[model samples]
Target: MLLERDNRLEQPDSFYAGLIAAHDGLSLEQSADLNFRLLLILANQIGRHDVLQAAIAAAREGVTA
Candidate 1:
């Protein structure tokens, strides 16, 4: 269960380009806010507690200082 939609983003290449385009000229805070909003939307769409938990764990698997 990936931390993403089953359909993923259609035309991934274009979506990637669009994401970059959206961030262009944004301040760091703006970019972070955009990311936060997108994450919430995607997370809601994912809608499986176990999958979300696993994905969160996997994402943090190597984080440390």
Candidate 2:
């Protein structure tokens, strides 16, 4: 399956707020850890190597080291 590129959330603002809220009290390292864990959880739900790879490439598009 191809990675979805559209906004699929029922309430995008609320979800964004909640995601930001989740790191409200976290240190930088803790926030990074939270993001890593969240990525793993969502990736597991996706459960497709090709789709995950596509998503990663899409996410990295225009991003520089």
Candidate 3:
């Protein structure tokens, strides 16, 4: 899910920390669902709508780029 962080890829440590907090006790599906909700909350809290949109667009743009 690094692709979902766009230019913010420079901050993997914080991302992984959040992911770990969100997924520490769940199954794969639960982890995914929780992570999704958590990301939404975080983006909203940070007022980072464009960043999120860019991240999603980047993901669709390609895995290699």
Candidate 4:
């Protein structure tokens, strides 16, 4: 699977809304923990070492740069 920009979600609005709603009423620490847990869960589901590493590097670079 290519890891570039794409519009693959069928229900983007609901998905984004749900994601935002998941963080509702949480402090920064709680929100960060929730996001990390969610990332681990989804990353495990992907289950590809190279893709996961590439994704992690790409995401980390964006923030640090």
Clashes of each: 0, 0, 0, 0
Residue 14 lDDT in candidate 2: 98
- Tell me the TM-score of each prediction against the true structure: 0.76, 0.87, 0.51, 0.87
Q: Rate the local accuracy (lDDT) of all candidates.
A: 0.85, 0.93, 0.72, 0.91
How close to the true structure is residue 50 of candidate 2, measured as C-alpha lDDT? Answer: 94
In the range 1-65, model 1's lDDT, one tens digit per residue, is 45554665669899899989989999999999999999899889888989988888977887874
What is the clash count of model 2? 0
Distance (Å) between predicted and true CA of 19, model 2?
Answer: 0.4
Candidate 4 Cα lDDT to native: 0.91
For 1-65, candidate 2 gives per-residue lDDT tens digits of 49666889999999999999999989999999999999999999999899999989988996988
lDDT of 4 at 41: 99
1-65 in candidate 3: lDDT tens per residue? 43343465667899778768867879999978886898688778767667677776776778764
Please identify model 4 stretches exceeding 4 Å from their true place. none
Better of 1 and 3 by lDDT: 1
| Residue pairs with clashing backbones, model 2 | none
TM-score, candidate number 2 = 0.87
Q: For residues 1-65, write the lDDT of model 4, one tens digit per residue.
A: 54757887899999999999999999999999999999999999999899888898888988965
Off by over 4 Å in 2: none
lDDT of 1 at 9: 63
* Higher-lDDT candidate of 3 and 4: 4
